[model samples]
Target chain A: MTAGATDKAGISWLPGRQAGLALLLAPALVYYFVVLFLPQLEIATASLMAADGRFPVDTNFRRFVTDPFFLSILWRTVRLSVISTLLAVIVAYPIAIYLSQPWRRWRAVVAFAVITPIMISAVARSYGWVIILGPAGLLNQAITGLHLGTDPQHLLYTETGLVIALTHLHLPFMVLPITAALQQIDPSILRASRILGAGSMRTFWRVTLPLTLPGITAGATIVFCLNGSSFVTPALIGGARIPMMSFLIYQQGLDVRDWNFASAVAIVLLLSTSTIVIAHLIWSGRRQRRAAGAA
Target chain B: MSLPLTSQVFLEVEDLALSYGKSAFGLAGASFSARKGEVIALLGPSGCGKTTLLNLIAGFLVPDHGSIRVAGRSLRGVPPHRRDMAMVFQNYALFPHLSVEKNVAFGLEAHQVPRQEREPRIADALAMVGLSDSRTRYPRQLSGGQQQRVALARAMVVRPSILLLDEPLSNLDTLLRKSMREEIRQILDRTGITAVLVTHDQEEALVVADRILLMSNGKIEQIGTPEEIYERPRTEFGARFMAVENIMAGSVCSGDTAGTTVNTAIGQFKCTPCDVVTGANIKIAVRPERMHIVAATSGSQSYENRVTGRVVRSTYHGTYRRLLIAVHGMELIVHAPVSSDDSEYSGDVQLTWRPADTHVLLQ
Candidate 1:
């Protein structure tokens, strides 16, 4: 008889092993069902009902779609989010590359600097932006001190100022994922490309960028979502002059006490973000497939 | 830029040296050359500077002192991509995202071989490596051996001036390593491409290289044909690295044109004539397999060197029986054909070897 043949199966209470796996997953399953899905189900059903309990529950939806003010707010929110998301991705790529090199002595310091803003409360951080983006703030002072301008830069309560703040807030989210992807790439792969007669620039374009696309996709999705849903930065920096979807949802639900209209607006925001995110996922997924298939 | 097709000297490295810190040196004054289409193996154990030499030639590293030349032109400031040399990495380093076809086409595209000229060359390279059917498969989808073939194809497709293989077969299973070493040698021979291979395995160097550069302690121990390096290693380091079993310290007692005689702690021995002065301390090596355990009565016969010793232990190795015999003050290993009966090995046995088999190692 062989040695292994005489040994009994392990873990007596978990005979099949499948049951043990299910038991291990019980906590997360219960939490998601109780704390996430059930409340979302109620809000989804309630979003279709009118406030007065009247027939033709499409009352809030029609009012929201026909209003110019609400539509403009929606447009401004999407515009600012997209512009900021793009800005964050553009600025984060180089920083991600730098952070991924383990041999750099200052890597830890740079990483801490990148993620420091995220640790502070968003309200406090938005207030900091408010100070700098004021009419005669540090930015304008620097602009004049450089002897480049005496012009009145309307950064305070402007769309550009809000975008700058959002990009700063979400920059870490963008850098971390791309850094992970860059670290995953084998260094020899880069060396191989060089040995094959491609210079550094061509190697980056042909090998580094394509291999790190998944990281870029993940970062973009996260930054876009965070920017779209954020209320504090916009409310403080943009103020009443530049209203956004989040502020509108807040004003409608609490101050005006129009719960149905608020719910309808929330639903619209959720749907818009989901549609864009899904489109992006599909595009990236198909691109990955094409990369594999073309070989 | 013409190489004269008659295969002139293609690569030359003169006194190459590199160091990491004050106490640690990576390579020290290594110098060698390869004729056009000649395959040279840089053979050494780990930390012995073989890979450093390969990198210096490939331009991934620049020597702290010395010059590397291709076709007699200095490569002091040339970049790797501009050197027209391609490398096959040990891990295969196939482009993970690209298919087999695209991986093979990468070099052609980088060199801009022209779209019309690319397809035929890619096909030829793939066929050369026997991977034409797996063109559409991604690197992740293929086995390790297949990926290695793709790597070979990718390097070959570039038609590089020099092919650098950095321990290319070190990652393969033993069975595959045995097969791939022979295949790589055949490919190099068939194409007549100038190549340099770095390996820690001596057998690999013997099988795949026209010449072997043995290294030790960040310096070269010897460079010669495989048989020369194995059968007549000039240094003790080379002998040990080549798995020489019997290395005994001795003093040269006398010298003549016929042979040099050395006296050791156990007894006196005769070896091939050397240029060393008589009465100098030296070391001599003999292979275990070269020694013979003759019958006890044959001790009286005419043999160049003869000794009788008591058997300490005997091991059965299927085809051969290894007798570990205790001489006067030292032990010697002798390999003899397995006798009909294993019981007789416990008695004292007489050993014999020719004078030519005794090798004097130079310091």
Candidate 2:
């Protein structure tokens, strides 16, 4: 008999072998069904049901599509999330590069500082931003003390405040992945570039930037998804002056007691986020294929 | 003493010194020069400042003292990118994200060469390295030797004033190392580029370098051609490094116009003319292959230096037999050519060499 056939027969001959495989997968399967699948299925069903709960209809979805107020909230949510992700990337790139250097002690200190905000509660962190962006807060005090402007500008309860808070919240996610990518790069490659008559700026543009694309894409993806679905920071810092999709969903479900409409909004948010993520995946996959074909 | 300045002097490093941190004993007062179209090998063991010296010349590490000159121009305050020198790293250092063609064209692009000119130069470099077919391949797609060739092409494409290599063949297998060493020598000769190579392999230095600068403990021990280094080592370290296995310590007994006599543990031996006073301490060295072995009963007893020893161990090395002999409680290694008739001799043998073969080290 062939070795493969004999091994298969022996495995099948043992009692409870299949049961053992089932047992190994039981916990994860059960957890996924109870915690994730059930809630999503209920939301899908509720999103289609009418307000009187008589029969399934598309009333909530129709309202969502036809109402100009809901449409504007969705658009604003997308725009703000994109801006926050870009801001995080701009702030994190230099920090990631610095952390990738060989300075051990300083890197540890800076890394701790970057991740410290995440350890605090999101509400508390939002309040901290409120204190700083308030009229009588530290920023206005510094501006007036430095004589840079005549009056203290009102920054709280605005889209700018929300963007700043969201960017700070997601900064660590952006820096960590890029730092890992930078650290994986071989130091001799940089030295070789310099020896081959490339200045530091050229080396960064040609070699460093291209090599770190995977990390940047990963970090941007994470920040975009999280900020798009976030509820707390926008509610506190934006203060109804700028309405986002998450705040409207919260208002519909809990404050107004419209569970069906809330479910519909949640479904829309999930669909749009999934669409963007899948598109990004396809684009990056094509790039990887092109790279391989060239090789 | 200073040599006359000539346009042929491509690179000159004078009184270069550097120390790691505050340590008092790093590379000190090293000076060397290379002429145009000459390949100089910095031959030494590990931790012998060979790589440090290369880094200094490449402007990666600034010297604490002295100056490096290229074609009689001082290279002070010049960054590595501005310095007209290229280096082939030991690990090849090919960019994983770039294709072979793009990697070779990187230097030209940095220098702002026109696109039309760059394309032809890139093609020429790839053709020279015999990788024209693999131009679109990335570094990860090539074998170790192929990646090394790509690195060589990239470095040479710049047409820099000097080329530096740091143990370029150290990562290859033994058989590949031999072939690559010869290939590198051929490439350098064809290009006529002034190059400095750092390596610890004596055989590689002997084969590839036009001149070898032997170093020890951050100091140069000797500088000479391969033949001179093999035949006439000036110090004990140089002799031992060259694999001259027979070294004997003794004191000078007498000196004359003809030759000198030295007394040692084995016997008094006559040596070639050397500058040493009578009663001064000395050491003598000779290569194993230069010693002749004969049966104890043979009638060849007229040699100047002779010793009687018993064979302690013998090893068969396919082409030759290496025999260890016990003479006066000291073991001496001797290499004898493998032959049908000489394989039978075992116990007692007489070794002899002419006085001219003995190298006297007075230090």
Candidate 3:
């Protein structure tokens, strides 16, 4: 009798709770529908139209795939996005580890310094990077100062410069998630690893790194997706010589007045990012299943 | 200190101290020694430096002063990994990514144990913890008791000089806590490894430890066998922590070879004296369980201390009845065993106890 009463009581409150949750989520749902889904749906429909405006056509996609100019732009976009994302991971780990230490006297200051840069406009940060990556910039001066007898390298308008700028721009995205993960690690687990006779480096390898894999994956996805669709940093840093998929979409849509082709390029970029993210999710999920299944 | 004479002292901490800011000692010159196969429990309330002392021993926290030695070698500059110690954490600290067998094998791999010998050892450790059948399962898949067992297996497989347990049973429910504490005690007995268990649960300490180091405010209040610590606590903190509810402030009425009768608002009560003289202002305490209801028991002994009081309230505990008696403007607690006639009695009742049960406090 009490069980039936409790079941009814449990069932009764759920709809009200769900309604309240839906009410709370109403704004985000509406915003995503209007600001995100509608534009993407419009782009998808436009991307399928031929130049003569016929429905269900693939001429724009065919042009993008066959044209080497657009193809190189696609490859460059993926290559730069992957490299910058990898670099962000490598850079974010040490910074995240430093920020995760609650005992450090200047930890709050360091965390502020790492995170507050995101508040600055992306264009302003790109300009700051332009100063550093210029021929007479801080990076070139430091490189030549090492006395390798090399001239000032032209990094201001190159793919390498674009990668450096993107890495800097997306650092906070990577570091914030990784820092949260690092801090979430139980301190006693690290101590347990140490007391079990693993040194600091070994503990990091065997314990800390594996535990923060989810955070790294999340950060990498965000950085890679952002870099894939990036417009400003590439335009300012790489210039016209190193055009990305986003740059092609911008140039074709507005300057060249090819809406169908531009929408196709946009859809391609979206699909590529989604494909990579989904494939990675599947791989990690399988790995977790294998881990759970292994003796 | 209670170990057999044949066993050598395996772990020694001397004057180990760490101070926060400038003045407050995190651990104020704390020192204790454990024999080769004895279990020592650091029993205390929270924020009393029990965990700080455990961390110092594990080499997780460095001491500001003094030294720790294992097998007669000073561990002044040694890192935690090189200290030859293992800690079973309160949260179990199992590697979430690793399965049971691999988690057990982690320490061996870190120590570079031979590839051929690892499997058998892991299997044996699992069997010891009764987790051999669940070797493929991750820690999150296991129950809390199972996780604790895995933690024990992982710690014991390393065969360190000293095994440390930091409130390993606090996370378990009461029923599981009881069984696990007994299991832990059994495992330690079988392994005969020197262990330092840090716990706030005095009952857990009494059940699992050979000797209890009662601590308060960064210092060892008293250290003795569980029997000695419980029956004859040296400090008020020790008595209170051990559940002595009737701690009262009194002065020595008179003293001789027999016992000391203290004067308090409750009344003069004769008790076994310790380090006191007449007319000295001091505090005294007694365990409530030692005070028996005179009428409840058929024929009460001629208890040296007797008080007639009105039973203000009576609470029925499963094992015994707790009665609050108002005696001479002061409340005293008496525990009455539920005899065949378990009827509630709430009136004037005589409570009695012998002098030896009343523990006269030294400080």
Quantify all predictions' global Cα lDDT against the true fold: 0.89, 0.87, 0.88
Here the TM-score of candidate 2's chain B is 0.93
For candidate 3, lDDT tens digit of each residue in A1-295? Answer: 2467775566454467578689879999999999999999999999999878899998999998999988898899999999999999999999998888888889888888888768998889999999999999998899899976489989988988899889988899999999999989998889889999999999999999998988998899899999998899998898788888888888899999999999999999999888998998888777767766543
Interface RMSD of each: 1.5, 1.3, 1.3
* Model 2 pairs whose backbones collide: none
How well does each candidate reproduce the native contacts, as fnat?
A: 0.70, 0.63, 0.79
TM-score of each: 0.93, 0.92, 0.89
Cα displacement (Å) at residue B227, model 2: 2.0
Residue-level lDDT of model 2, residues A160-277, one tens digit each, is 8789999999999999999988998888888889888988998898888887888988999999999998888888888577878888889999999999999999999989887888
Q: For candidate 1, lDDT tens digit of each residue in B1-363?
A: 123446777899899999967644399999898899888999999989888899988888888999998999999999999999999999999888888999999999999899999999999999988999998898877878998999999999999999999999989999999999999998998898999999999999999998889998789999998989998889999998988788899999999889999999978999988988999999999888878877754344446887888999888899898888899868998877787766666788778888888999998
* lDDT winner: 1
Each candidate's chain A: what TM-score?
0.89, 0.89, 0.90
lDDT of 2 by residue, B1-363 (tens): 112346377889898888887553367778888888888999988888888889989988888898999989999989999997889999999888888899999888877788889988898888987899998887878888898899989999988889999999998889988998898898898888889999999999999888889988878889988888888888999999999899999999998878889999999988888879999998999888878787555565447789989889989888889989899998888888887776544788888888877888748
Residue-pair clashes per candidate? 0, 0, 0
Chain B only, TM-score of each candidate: 0.94, 0.93, 0.95
TM-score of chain A of 3: 0.90
